[model samples]
Target: MIGQILINGLLNGFVYALVAVGLSLTWGVMDIVNFAHGEFLLWGMYAAFWIWSLVGLDPLISLPIIVVLIFALGVLTYLIVIRRVLKVSGLTALLATFGLSMVLKNLTQFFWTANYKNITNPLVSNKSFKVLGMYIRQDYVVAAVGALLLTMLVMAFMNKTKTGVAIKATSMNKQAAQLMGIDTSRIYAITFGLSGACVGAAAALMASFTPIYPEACALYSTLAFVIVALGGFGNIKGALYAGLIIGVAEALGGYLIGTSYKYLVVFLIYLIVIQIRPRGLFGW
Candidate 1:
């Protein structure tokens, strides 16, 4: 039983890590906390759904397209809406994103009628394998592996590429990066796009098994924020580790204390961690 819970939690954690990494990146690079971040994931889900419905493309097959589309949307958002608030107060940026979130959610509900939808006949649907006396869903495994690979790719991009280095530099000190001849605006746009891509990939994986709805992003978004805070804001590694911890913790808590109190346990941990280490486990 314990092992089964661990496996389930770990798989869920990988997905959470993927979702939170984008939030970490944008926060690190632009110091902007996007309240609309979850909406990006929601849009990604919708994008995958439409592609599958219209073109008969599997979510896995359409993953790249979804990522690219979301990336473009992120860049456009940066150029159009976020750019104006770049120099404004953090509160203003927060409000802007919050408003964007509301707009996206309402628009989704308006068009989709708050309906819950899921992919039918997905490749990984209704498949499971037994391992060490525990049954593991194939969809969960695929999503976990995909999230892991994408997380590594993002880490490599940030650590190995020249553009990634410039992004890191900008995150460290925007004025210094500007003085060094780096175009901060472009970097910001790229970062937002990358973040969107991360969420896009996550959404695609999730759509394979999870039901989609107009407000589907709400819980995931809240959990992403909690993971970011638990891991430390602007820290990718921290987010990854924190995601796993929270995942396992929630699973265990759900099993031990009942599912109703699972999230209560998570929030309690978050509150305790915040009180003890406001900077988070790995926040600098």
Candidate 2:
């Protein structure tokens, strides 16, 4: 039971971390909270689904397309809409994004309806391995491994590259960095696009784990907010910790209290944690 719980928590946490990393990155550098972030993930899911279903490509193989499509959408929005919001107050920016979220959610429903769609990957149901006396699902393992690779790559990119350094500088102190000659606007745009790409990859992988639905991304949006809050606003490392904690809490709570009340348990714990630390467990 213990091993099973750990495995489940880790995989679920992996997805949560992947999705929230983008949010953290954007919040860190741009200070523009994007309520529309998950919609980009949802777009990626549909992108992967359509690519696979129409072109007969494997879901994994279509990841690039998913990333590109969502990245382009993000960049376009940055140039057209978010650019205007950058100079506005945080509340205005938040409202701008909230409007975007509503548009994307409703647009998806209009086109796709609320029916669930999935990429029929057999590895999920067909393959598994016993790990420390627990039968671990191969698909979840794939998701975990994929999430790890993506996270590592993002971290490495942020740590070693000049562009990455600029992003961090902006995140840490935008005004100081701007005075130092860094193009703050460029950094903001790059951050948005990259964050979108991260969530896009997450969405593609998430589709492999479960059925895709229009409202699924909407659900993930709330989860993303909880993750960012639990992890600490604008802190990727904190997001990681928060994701694992929430994942384990949910797993254990579902086991003990039934899945129906699972969300209540998550929120209650989140509230308790926030009370103890308003910024988050690892707010910078």
> Model 2 TM-score?
0.94
Clashes of 1: 0
Report the CA-based lDDT of candidate 2 relative to the real structure: 0.82
Error of 2 at 94 (Å): 0.5
Q: Which stretches of candidate 1 lie over 4 Å from their true place?
A: none
How far is 210's C-alpha from truth in model 2 (Å)?
A: 1.7
lDDT by residue for model 1 (223-251), tens: 99999999988888889998898899899
lDDT of every predicted structure (CA atoms): 0.91, 0.82
The most accurate candidate by lDDT is 1
Off by over 4 Å in 2: 122-126
